[model samples]
Structures are given as structure tokens and as C-alpha cells.
Target: MPDLGKYADAVLSSYAVSLVLLVALIALSIARSRRVARELHEVEERVKHG
Candidate 1:
């Protein structure tokens, strides 16, 4: 936590933006992975039965 002094607002805003983007990316990836996994499980079941 170096003293940002006069540059505090600019630095803080950039950090905030970065944090939001990273969280959004992680959330989307998790959702996509779940969907893909479900589809794969369904395909496997179909093949096993048919």
C-alpha cells in the first residue's frame, strides 16, 4: 500500500476495473464448463444405451 497521494483516484479506479473484469471472466468460464460437462454426460449416456 504505497501512498498513492494525488494519484489515488486514478489508481484505485484502474484496480477496480481490473477486479471486475477478472471476476466476470471466471464466472462465465465456470458456467460454460458446467454446461459442456452436462452435454458430454448426456452424450455418453445415449451411446451407452444405444
Candidate 2:
């Protein structure tokens, strides 16, 4: 890595925070997708039976 000089700490911390937030957002989206799919399946089954 190139020397960031005195700004190294600030730049690296910003990258770290951005990566963490990106991962969290992806995780939440996947979880919500699974939940919605499951609920939709249940509703479909209920409608089919009734």
C-alpha cells in the first residue's frame, strides 16, 4: 500500500466503516428475502386448501 502519510488513520477507518455497513445491508436483505418467501409459500398453501 502506498504511504498515506498523516491521513492514513482517517482513510483506513472510513474504508472499514463502509465495508461493515455494506455487509450489514446485504445480510439484512437476504434475511428479509427468506422471510418473505416463507410467508408467501404459507399463504399459497392456505389458499389452495381453502
Candidate 3:
């Protein structure tokens, strides 16, 4: 491992922030994809029954 003795707090904080942002982005993308899929399915069903 690298030496993080002098800037340990800064390094840890940076890593934590990056991790939080990445998780947030992934969650958002999954939610949006689910919403779009549901809409598409509904449209397809309407087309088939109409």
C-alpha cells in the first residue's frame, strides 16, 4: 500500500465522496431504466390490444 500518513484524512474523505457519488449515479440510472422499461411495456400492450 502507498503511504498516506501525512494526508490520511484528506485521502479518506476524497475516496468517500467519490464512492458516494458513484453509488448515487448507479442508483439513479437503474431507477430511470426501470421507469423507461415500464413505459415501453405499457405502450406495447396498448398497441397490441388496440
* Most TM-score-accurate candidate: 2
lDDT of model number 3: 0.97
Which regions of candidate 2 fall more than 4 Å away from where they truly are? none
CA lDDT, candidate 3, residue 12: 92
Clashes of 2: 0
lDDT of 2 at 41: 99
The list of candidate 1 runs beyond 4 A from truth reads none
In candidate 1, position 8 carries an lDDT of 98
RMSD of each: 1.0, 0.5, 1.1
- What tens-digit string does per-residue lDDT give for candidate 1 at 1-50? 99999999999999999999999999999999999999999999999999
Reference-based TM-score of each model: 0.87, 0.95, 0.87
Question: Which scores higher on TM-score, 2 or 3?
Answer: 2
Residues 1-50 of candidate 3: C-alpha lDDT, one tens digit per residue? 68899899899999999999999999999999999999999999999999
